[model samples]
Target: MPNRLALKRKSAYLAQLGRCYYCGLPMWQDDLDSFSRAHNIKPSQAKPLKCTAEHLEARQDGGLDTAQNIVAACWSCNQRRHKRKKAPAPDAYLDLVQQRVRKGRWHCAPLLTAFGALFAGHDSGGEATS
Candidate 1:
């Protein structure tokens, strides 16, 4: 059988329709090589767009790995959240990501522009607030 976390991640990915829950970008659930080829980016560049299981309530703070608590996020957004000294709540973080993604400040790689071309129709309006 597949690993539980992987299944959960896949479930979340599908639930989100392959979109990153945080940044609202397209993500690769598996096969970085394929993702790289599809996006025409290097493996290093593609790594940030891989799908990951995100905890709406962090595990460290007693959040369980149940489906209700899990959501799919991109590797970049996942890291961006945990990298903070104090990770913000999911809704708050979502707002922050929306702001940055709207202004195209969340991701700067040209590869993301190419990736966006593959899966268009994301409208992140408004400005990024401090």
Candidate 2:
């Protein structure tokens, strides 16, 4: 049987439709090799591109480890978020992400651009922000 954390992660991933909550980047389930090669990192060290269970209210702040409090996030966003002295509330963070997206500050533009070729004609209106 899968562990609770693994189960939660899976649930969050599906709930978010495999997209990074912060950046809207598609977290491809089967792109480990491509992600590793692109970053020139070993698979073991490529967690940034992997989906992680992120706490809306960080555990250190007395957040419960419950489904309602968790969301799927990319490793990069998770790491960057934790670096801040205070974790922002989920709504605030999401607002910031939307603002960034509208300002053409997408964090994973290159990857999306590459994937764009294969997924031609399915634009997500990302370019309008630029």
Candidate 3:
């Protein structure tokens, strides 16, 4: 049987439609290996841009390991939260994430634009530039 953490994470991921609960970014299920499990108060070893399990309240602060306290988040967002000296209330942190998402501040967009520009002038055929 799967552990409770795994079960909760899976449930949250499915319930949220694979979206990062904080930033509202899409977490692709096709690339499951790239996702991470992040805690509100603890940093995850997993790399960024992956789906992570975020705790609405830190376990150290007497938070329960129930589904209500868990959410799906991207690794980057989760890491940012972990850096906080004092974790903000879940509601406040969520509001901040929503604000950032609305502002289009997530990392993926700019990287995509840059890659597009870099390849825009290149031909698929093997041709050497003068």
TM-scores of all models?
0.84, 0.71, 0.67
Q: Which lDDT tens digits does candidate 2 get at residues 10-129? A: 888887667677766656455888877864556665555588888888888898779988888878777877888877777777777656655556455555454434233322212222
Backbone collision count in every prediction? 0, 0, 0
lDDT of 1 by residue, 1-130 (tens): 8888789989888877787888777789769999888767888887888888999899999999999999888888999999999999988999998787656688865755765553245532111224
What is candidate 3's CA lDDT for residue 19? 59
Candidates, ranked, lDDT: 1, 2, 3
Q: Of the candidates numbered 1 and 2, which has the greater lDDT value?
A: 1
What range of 10 consecutive residues in model 3 has the weakest lDDT sum?
A: 37-46
Candidate 2 vs candidate 3: which has greater lDDT? 2
- How accurate locally, in lDDT, is each candidate? 0.79, 0.67, 0.61
Candidate 1: segments with Cα more than 4 A from true spot:
116-130
Model 1's alpha-carbon lDDT is: 0.79
Selected candidate, larger TM-score, 2 vs 3: 2
List per-candidate RMSD values in Å: 4.8, 5.4, 12.4
Model 2 bad stretches (over 4 Å): 29-31, 34-47, 115-130
